[model samples]
Target: MIGLCLGLAGLVWAQVPTPAFTLAWDHTIEKIRWEEDYRVTPQGLLLGEARVRGSGAGMEIPEGAELKDGSWRYHRTLPPLQPLRVGRTPEAGDYQLCFDEQCHVLSEWLGPPTAEQPALELWSCAQVE
Candidate 1:
C-alpha cells in the first residue's frame, strides 16, 4: 500500500508544470551591461532575478509585453500570459522602439483599436501534444 501511494505521488509531481523557459536581456552602463532574467509562467511572464551595477540600473520589465529572446514580442495569448518569440516587427508602422541591438515595435492586432488602443496582437504560444 505504501509503495502504491508513493507511485501515485510521484506521478502527480511529474505532471506539475515547472519553470522550463527563461528569457534574458541586458541594460548597459558605459560599456558594462546588466542582465535580467524573466521566467515564463502560465499566469504571465514574470520578472525574476537580476544582476545590476547599481540599484534600478537594469532594463525595466516590459509590463504586459512578451519577452522575446532580447526583444519584447507582442502577445496574442489571453490577458496576463505573454508568450515569447524570435523575430522583428513589421516594417510599416509609425510606432517603433529600438535599443541595444534589439527592439519591440508596432506589431500584432489587439482590438477594434480606438485612438488610444490599437487593434492588434503579436507573439507566439506553445502547442498541445
Candidate 2:
C-alpha cells in the first residue's frame, strides 16, 4: 500500500504544469519602435522600421508611449527563437515568451489567454513590442 501511494503521488507531481513568468515593456507606445536589421547570405545588412499599434485604438507608438491595456499572447506556429528579456513593470502577468533555435524575437505574446471562452489570439512581428 505504501509503494502504491508513493507511485500515485509521483504521477500527480509529473502532471503539474510549468511555471510562467511575466514580461514588462520598457518604452511606451509613443516611444516604442520596431527596427529589424536583416542580413542576407550574399549581401551585408538591411534595416527596416515599423510602427506598433493597439488592436482597438490603432494609435501609433509615439515617443515614451506606454502600453495602456494589453496582455502578452503567444502563437504556436510562429515560435520565438530566443527567450525574452523581461523588464520591471506592474502590467506584467503570467506568461512565457516563446523563441526559436536561432534566438530571434519571433513572438512576444505567444501563450494561452486569461479567459477560456473568448479564445486566445496571437499577434506577430511589429505587432508585438
Candidate 3:
C-alpha cells in the first residue's frame, strides 16, 4: 500500500505544469511587425520568428514567436539600424500572447485603439503570437 501511494504521488508530482518563461523587451520595437512559427518538440512548444525590432524603451520581440538554437531571425526592408535578441522564458498569468506548440493571442481586449498611445500599445500586442 505504501509503494502504491508513493507511485501515485510521483505521478501527481510529474503532472504538475511547468512554469512559463518570461521575456521582456523595450517598448519601442512595438512599431515594427513580427511573426511566430510554432512546432511540437520534446521540450513542449518551440517558437521562432523571422524578425524583431529594437527601440529606446529596450527591445520588442514577438511573443509566441518561435525560437531556434536559442536565437531568432528578424528581417526588414531596411536593415534594422539596431536589432534586439528575443526568446526568453515567460512567466505565468494567461499572457495576452503565448506560445505552446501553437501561437495564440488573446482577442478580448484587442481591437482598434482610441488614442495614439493606445494605438501603439495595441500594435505592440499585435506582434505577439
Kindly list the per-residue Cα lDDT of model 3 for residues 14-37, writing each as its tens digit.
Answer: 111222312223232344333433
Clashing pairs in 1: 74-122, 108-120, 108-121, 109-119, 109-120, 109-121, 110-119, 110-120, 111-119
Which regions of candidate 2 fall more than 4 Å away from where they truly are? Answer: 1-18, 28-76, 83-129
Candidate 1 residues lying further than 4 Å off, grouped into runs, are 1-29, 54-124
User: How does model 3 fare in lDDT?
Assistant: 0.28
lDDT tens digits, residue span 63-96, model 1? 5655445544433333432432222222222222
CA-only RMSD, every prediction: 15.5, 17.0, 15.7
Deviation in Å, model 3, residue 94 alpha carbon: 11
lDDT of each: 0.31, 0.24, 0.28
Candidate 1 lDDT trough over 10 residues, lowest sum: 1-10
> Which numbered prediction scores highest in TM-score against the true structure?
1
lDDT of 2 by residue, 1-129 (tens): 000000121221111111211122224334332232221111211222222333333443455444433422222232332211223223323222222222222122233223332222221111111
Q: TM-score of each candidate? A: 0.28, 0.18, 0.25
